[model samples]
Target chain A: MRLAALLMLMMAAAATPAAAHAFLERAVPPVGSELATPPGQIVLTFTEGVEPLFSTIEVRDAHGSVPTGKPRLPPDNARQLVIDLPSLPGGEYTVIWHATSVDTHRTEGSYRFTVH
Target chain B: MSDIEIAAAVLRSVHVAALASLFGTLLFMAVALPVGSGTAQVRRSMRRLVLISGLAGLIAGLAWLTVQSAAIAGADSVAMALHVVPTVALRTQFGHWMLLRLFLLVVALFLMRRPGVAIQIALAGVALAVQPLLGHAGAIGGAAGAQLIASEALHLLAAGAWLGGLLPLFLAVGCLSHEMAAATCRGFTPIGLASVLLLAGTAVMQIATLMGGLPGLFGTGYGHVALLKLGLFVVLLSLAVLNRLVLTDRLAATASTRPHMRVSIAAEMVLGALVVVAAAFLASRTPGTHEQPVWPFAWRLDLGVFSDTASWAEPTIALGATAIGLAIAVAGVIWHRIRWPALGMFAAIEIVAIPHLDVLFVAAYPTSFFTSPTEFAATAIAHGARLFAADCAVCHGVEARGDGPAARSLPLPPADLTANHFRAHNDGELYWFISHGFTAPDGETAMAGFSGVLSSEAIWHLIDYLRAHNAGIAMRRTGSWPQPLPMPQFDAQCSGGRIIDLDDLRGRAALIVAVSGDEQVEPRSFDNIGAAVVVVARGIAATPTGATCIASEPQVWTALAIVLGVSLDALAGTQVLVDQDGWMRAAWRPGDAEDWTDPNTLAARLRDIQSHPIAVNMTGAQVHHH
Candidate 1:
């Protein structure tokens, strides 16, 4: 019975959910979204806290890449990253992000959202 | 593997082997060998071995650090890595641990010649214990992490005591008198046995934590390496058993067997070295559970058979026959006179049982157990829906019910993808059918493969879309979902510069309104009834007034429409009530009578949901019948 309990404990520990690396959890202008008006900035949130110094967010359109400000973590949430965008005409835009978590595991993804 | 990774693994193996040998030799001299049993020559040789292993460990530890620095710096050459070594050593946790290990080794080396065996063993043991802190075990947190780390430390110590002591034992057998040699072998047996038991137990714990279970063990690179290590370990154990049971007795009785015993010991040492190398390789690879498993077999046992009463008869008969056959064989073995008759009866029983057991098997593929690379989120589902329209709608139909425009053209009707039978196939099996296409038993092509047209990520998105589409159909037909679907998450601008998403409303019931911006409903009224309200406007200009949180994105309409199994126009004025766990519990359409807009009706629904919170399977994967 003791051996059975220890085996149960080990199995339970193995089943515990632990995030191995940073993943794109959610975004303000969500992936594949379309808007009636262009937004002033882009915000990206990850499943784990990320280092803003090593992380980056790049926005581009059909013409070429657009200039954006440096990515910064919000004061309240370390997992939230915000980047300011200049006023622009409406078109489909792609947002690419690279995140390095505190443990130094890195992940990158890209998605497109349209502005009418 | 890259050049830097290979270098690191090699250095790590050398470092661990050297340190284990040093610690193990000291331990054997202090505890296992009888006091005053070693002669001058034996004592001098033992001292030399300790000094050499200590120096080798120090050098290997430094080289390991250099390779790690190169990998972290992304340096192309040794010189560049050397330049950044100082930075890594000072700035990183890995570097700090390595420095501490080196300090411990240095102190142990200084005390090597002194008559302080206990101090030397303690210092070396501490240095070796620091190893797991630099590997995958260090990255984990919480109670499980602590358990993993502790098991790993004990595992290392046990390995050191056993594998590390092999060389010293070989040395003693070669040099000692016949009586002395026999005595030394007797002395080592208890220590070796204890170490082996400890090693095996700790290893099981580590495998449970790192490999997950049998599927992970058979389906990943890290697991393959671990299997290789286990193979080596078994051989080492067999040799150890041979020495203890056969060779030790012969050596005790006759002087002639000493040479033979030395040869066997040498083989054990070689196998032990191979085990260490395999462990080093495993440490460099990702843990098995984190990767997608490519199942190698074509058949898998589905315990799901037991869950269906109709399917239980065959397996039950198979198990009963096998059990009876085994009992008869055991009785025959004890009786001896009826052995041949019992053997014949057992064989006949097994032949009858085997076919019945076939019902438990299911057809599987190389990708049969693969998980989705993309998350089961709303965005991926929406993206998948678009892909399905462009590629799959011709034969599968817009609703995937096997009644498409091209259904009459195929030799076999397309499969109904939204049926309950669809849930039987796992994600990887579906991925295989989609990428490789389906073929009828008569050799006709039922569907063409989409590998040439759709990228792998696009295929995953398509699968996510199918899952959501199936859930929507189930909900519409049954008036409740067979399983809860997570609310498709969306972010919206809220008051006070604070952003809110559907996730933020968790821990309370939420009423998500898909409005046309023309509704007279007051959003704050739902809040008074103890539910958070989120308004999803059809268009940016259609933003509803007096709403603190609004999702005005256009894609939000299309995504939620897919879940509601409705068109964009039909999506307006739809409301879904989500439980505290973020699962969509109930949905109301625009034309439904006695709708949730009434406060009392909404309150009653909220009370029902709160009283019976769902035990959600967060991954949203289909559970097997068993």
Candidate 2:
């Protein structure tokens, strides 16, 4: 009886859903997008909750870094980081983000978008 | 590994070994010593083992904390580690768990001075249980995570009971009389059996969860260490079987076999210690699934070959022959008369089967199992298309049809990138071919290597473009997409004042309408239809009302254009039907179809898509092989 119970428990543990590692699930101005006009902000939603203090979102163009506010969590959402942007001239831009999940696992990625 | 990593691994191994030995000794004394068989000498020996192991565990546990602190603090010496040890012990989760473990050990040791077996067992068990909470098991959250943690704890306890019990059993064998020794051995058999069963079950669960599969098992450092542990365990299991089945019975019959039994048990103790060391190294390394697997073999098996009737005969004969050979080998072990004949028959079968088995394998490279670092996104595809025009188009051509101006001058013509055979090669294989260059069978340089010319990320971008280009070509020819393409994800605000993501629309049908610059779309034209209507409008001053969701994100138009194999301007009137599985099933171009705009026509299309769900080739979507 004990062996059978143990077997069932093992099966249950094996069948459970996979745990998260905080990959970027979605992004504003979406990855590899080409835009005709500039957006007001950049929003990144990850697979797991991230620590705002350790996370950063940097936007840059051909000349230098584009001015943006510090990365902050949106209202009632710990998994998202929002950055407010200023009015910018038309050019190609790259968005680089570094995120440290609440569990302390860190991941970083960069993608490009054009403002024509 | 660095010196600090090596130090941490050694300290962890020592702590685990000491704890297992301590727990095993107490457990044996409580349950498996056999009634009235605990002689003064036997009892004294057991007590001494417990004290030594318990003290060793305490010291090792403390030392482990110091080493871990040093690694985490980036410290260079013992003095530097000592300075930060207190901070680590007080401030971190690892520190808290270690403190709890140390307290349990102290209590278990104190209780051992008395005769309270249940309390001692409970304390030691809890101490061991603390380990899983500090390792990979604790990283997960939720009810399933709790269950996984429990399984890990049980696995550790079972190891302690079996491997740790060996030393105490050895002491019992040496100090007790022949009958008592045999009885003690009998008592341990069931405990060992139960531990082995639990160990096997938990090990399988861990492998399935963490190993990623066969590619991981053969490719990563963690999997290599796990394989080493498995090898040691198999040897230990064989020794255990020999002891229980053959040696124990001999010891029961006569006094002469006691020395032999002692030697066997001592060997098992050493093997178990080695297994613990391998496990420690495994724990320190990243899980196989997280690492990029560099496939080590020259050839890889592809069972998909069996789908072809012409290719079935050789592999079938090889498999059948192998089964027969194994059966004969097992029979040879059971019967002495057939031993030589069985060996010869097996050898003959192997010689025939080995060559035929080649039909099941294909040539492989070091990067054959490597997953692309870049996702199959439009930006990547766009970037790759530019790179291909600059570097690859000279020979492969702008259309990748091997008809470039330079193609006629080359020794061999470049291969067509959009052929059906192109789908057979995985993203990794294509990445390798593109970066390292392809060589024809006749020794001609079919393509030049581009490693120095392009970055690794750039190569991945190029591969993404190739896939999208091929997909685009196939889609144009088929009217419907040849394979399912994931809808490019975007964030939007819905009409009901709710924020929604394109990914959130999965498990239901959605009609994505791309409107460019003041193109009047009847917001409720496709209303009352089963599918959700998502308007991806650009250059519009106001958000459209009555749509399920609306996004003015300009990039959404560009991304959708790439999928439809058209320009940004050409994307304005194109409407795509995405099925419940999140795959783009059918598309309606501007001038091609006005019928899909009707409510009845759109609803009928939704039903058709719902009934015939596309079989998405997940590998094309994302490479999952670590």
Candidate 3:
């Protein structure tokens, strides 16, 4: 029953509004949430389907240097960009994403998540 | 004229005249020249002319081959010119036919010098027949191509008979006695008349196939030369008529009349030669079909009633003329007086009218993206949204409901984007509006045109967005989203190395659903239920603790959209229920009147799905046991 209520709330939120820009909606680590273990890949979902060819998301260490494999967009989700991260020591990491949606409209944002 | 042009013209004329001479000589010796004391002398004279003409034609054909090779290679070196002969002869249709004709002409010449008249005639006919294979008729495909080639061959033969035989006829008229002259004229009249008729009919067919229509008979250099040739032919026809009806009679009646007859006959021969020269000029230019840049896209006012500006004008004129011609033909038949001439006139009119009618139609209604619009896709809406947001959203609201922040300062509010007014006009008109921008009748600019800014494709995307938005509004208003039931098994890859194969979950009911785009679901809703729950999460796949979560598959999304009976636009927010045994039971969407939010109703629907065992048809809900 509590889960049902949550479903209703999420459905209501989805129905309330939609936007054209590729704003970062959520991430696998849930945007700034600390994880017990670092994820193999960092996934960033957007407001709209982003064109992977023109779009990029880079994971950088605290020093602002790339610390991951090339960003790959899984075909299952056009709106999300997934990049494989190398094994990392416990520290704060930043994801910098610049998305060009299928419409060629460009949007950029950055979010930080920590690994224990 | 350029050197190439001049050479081509000269070679073409020489080749055509020589071929015509060969054809005409054979025809005159067979049909017109009387068998008598002068037959040997006449035969020797004809044989000399035929041999000369055949040799000249072969030389000209070889020269043509070399010149064509040089032109094709874009080189002028003697080596390349010489190289072209075999290349053309081996590669091109024209070269092949020319080679064949040249070879056959050689054999015919050999046969002509001997006593084998029938074989010589057959060889000459074969040489002429090979000619159409060198020209436009050779390029045609299918049954029409065969027909055109046949028609062109006949046309060439008729041309050779009528024009090539002229010199021989004139020579006989001058040298033979008045009695022989009169006899020769009478003998040649029927053959000339038949050849002329054949020539005219075949000319009409070649004109239709090569020129496309009457419009092709104008504007282009080819058209001009053809018109000149056509004029010469008319004069030749008139001369033939005059000679047959008047001059032939005079040849027998008076000595003075014989001189006039000879002079008239000479003039006819000269005109016939000029016509052949004109034909040579015509051949040097591109055929109407291949003359793309010069293909006359002409349209003119028809009978002061129809204009080419109207798309329907050409068809209306053609159909109307045919109807009138047919009516007149039938009337003439019933009256029994003017039927034959009426029928002839109808044929003449069609020959003149039909080919150019298509040209007029094409000119009137040219094809473009505007003429045939592409259907809109969801991606188009996304692209259009971006453009609309960047450009129009300042004046038109973000939602395009038209109350943008900038709209307050304007004299007129921006047009309501959600309104159904856009549905009234066609996509092309809408495109034009976007390109040129909305302009008031009073000459005030409302929305600035994006023609210089956004491409036509971008504008189309904008139009697609508007259309999709309008459809969404209509769907919302209808209070029913038709999502079909009876879900089928499909494949999906899940997060914990688990493949959520729907077919494998047959005996156990599964709540197979997708949470994609903006939609989110309570992942733990199936925690207490006995049924299995698999979430095909697209985008963010943060499932509740107990639920099996899979990354969405393309097939799963497609199958979800279909089985759920939801438009792809609404599929992102839909949930599908598969009954025990893998048959899709039901689907639910947001904004549906059903109380899906209530746990009791959700439980009841799942129980109902379980109770109705066996294969249950979704539409009729008829349960049948295997």
Candidate 4:
């Protein structure tokens, strides 16, 4: 199934179907695109509110699980979800996100990028 | 309803009820006071009916005042000084109107015993006219304010006629002799017509105020309530017509069948009471955000003839319907003394006219209540549940303790909260407390202090959720704090903004921020609040800039700098200049020794000095100096 999924992705279009409840929208980097340099911060946008507690975001490089800072809300606005990434080496990186709002809405998603 | 909302509603209800009782007594006195020479029989009967309604109304006014004590506070009020005003009355809400109304009420009551209907009617009208300006809506300015005052007047008069008219109609049906019944029914025409016109005027004003234009009626909660009121009003009007056309004819045609009119009158009275109850509920629920401004963007409710969008826009010839209404008001005024179809016609007209109002008078609220549904709902529910538990739960319970652990400990066992508390009473009775709250002068029941403990939002939510909770009704409480107001952020202006040192101006005898000896004031000089550099914007004229040193002594500059939190040496470089306005301008760091127009500019210069607002953000965001 993993091989099938990876194989299918090579031929599939870049898109995700809409569903009920809050979900992630655009991420900072084009999800599947290669990048020249790793971003200093990873920001996630959600259609509905997210709980800062359960919701977590992580950036893992080739060396694995680098220490990270707790997600910080932008001083200008709280509703928009955000997370700062740890310093990473030049390698493939994956950003995973998860969280739930008090209203019981839940969401999770992932994207990967490469450093120069 | 939070306490403030309930207090607001309470103050409104108390004023309304007080106004009603005051007006009702006057009307009763007006109709009941005249003695005619021909018949001692008719004179005596009129006097009895007048006395009953007038005094009973005064009692109701007392009831209104009793509920009102919690809303208005402070002693030595005009109400306190008035010998006749009830002990419970808060006289200040009425200002000058109360004295005039009291005099009118007294004269009418006195005249009813003596007989003189014409004198009473005119006086009653005057009393009604004066009470319109003393409501919540009128407190605001502009079109919205005018509509509120107008709507409240109509509302009060309509209520007086509708609710106040009930007592007379009831007596005419059940207890009055055949002559009295006929006379009473006949007397109703003028009162009804006068009442209906004012009601119609008020109805229009209130609709205009709340729903804005008709299109606004659906999107806003105010609009929803408007629709509900319009629907109920139509029903009341139709029944009113039935009383006039169908029932009045039967009763007048034969003396033996007059008993039947009593049943019909009872039904109508019941309906009137039901409407009153609805009015009370209507009063309690918040009026929608005024939709008047949004009319061009949407369509109003479909008039059957005009609703092309809904295809229900069909016009009925309401001319005949309106004729029935106007004939009574005109006939009543033309001859208030005639005992005929005029009174019946007035009731017919009024009942019929209930639905056409535009701006509905409602309490105004800050915009935050409209934008945040979660916070609003939560506040209302929390207030309601807490109030219910305090007031109703003495019988209902904490956790609905009808027979819980704390059941045996109190003066009254608590009522069950979920017992569908909302349905136990209509909006009128619930409004009596849910709007005003229950209070006892002496420390009596634990439930007495609802106004102090819970908010009006909570009371309303409790009411909305509680209405006879015997079965499947669901309830919810919202817990949203409103989103904090967005703080302003100035865009970075300087292309190469950098920290500068203003240390050069320090320790000197006030470095003069000198422009040349010519005068032309720059607009940006308006932003400076610093005392160190006083820009003499050419003092009086721009003829001679003479922008020489108004440089105060160094002691003055340091003191002024200390006062303003400005930097002395902060303006060392980075395009520092003295503008034509003669004020020094420079870019500086945030944590500076001195204050500048923009904090970001000042903090950039400070580099090391710290303050709460800037420091909290800097440490949190982890911004550092290069």
User: What DockQ do you compute for every candidate structure?
Assistant: 0.19, 0.14, 0.02, 0.01
User: Which 10-residue span in candidate 4 chain B carries the lowest summed lDDT?
Assistant: B484-493
Clashing pairs in 1: none
Docking class of predicted structure 3: incorrect
Q: Rate the local accuracy (lDDT) of all candidates.
A: 0.78, 0.78, 0.64, 0.44
lDDT per residue as tens, model 3, B424-460? 4445456666777666567777777788999867887
TM-score of 4: 0.37
Listing candidates in order, what is each one's chain A TM-score? 0.87, 0.83, 0.79, 0.70
Q: Lowest lDDT 10-mer window, candidate 1 chain A?
A: A1-10
Which prediction has the highest DockQ against the true structure?
1
Looking at chain B only, the TM-scores across the models are 0.88, 0.86, 0.54, 0.41
Tens-digit lDDT track for model 4 on B1-626?
44533444444444444445445544654564233444355445545655664565455444434333323322244454243234323324333344466567667677764444677656654555555433334333245455566667667676776556655565545545555556666666666667767776666656544433333454465566666767766776676667666666666666676767776667765665555555554554434432212222211211223324542221223334555666767777788586367778767655664333211112221211122111112123334444555656544554453665555765654455444333433332343444443333454563443555556445545543343122112211211101111111011111122111122222211122212234333323222323122322212222212222222123222222221223434321212222222122232333535555454444343332211112111111111111
Interface RMSD of each: 5.1, 6.7, 28.0, 22.6
Query: Higher-DockQ candidate among 1 and 3?
Result: 1
**By TM-score, how accurate is candidate 1?**
0.84
Give me the displacement of residue B458 in model 1, in angstroms.
1.8
lDDT of 2 by residue, B1-626 (tens): 77888888899999999999888888998888976735778988899999999899999999999988777666798899899899777865567889999999998888776877888888888888777776656655556557768888989999999999999999999989987898889999988999999998888777656665555666888778888888999999999999999998999999899999999999999999999999888877767766667788787666667778888887888778977997998898889999999988988987887677676668888778777755465456667888888999889888888888899977777989877677778877887898889777898887888888899889988887777677667767776656556776566767644557655776678888887775886665444555688887878854546756877666566667666777778778778888877778889986785586676788888878878876643432363221
TM-score, one value per model: 0.84, 0.81, 0.47, 0.37
Clashes of each: 0, 0, 7, 105
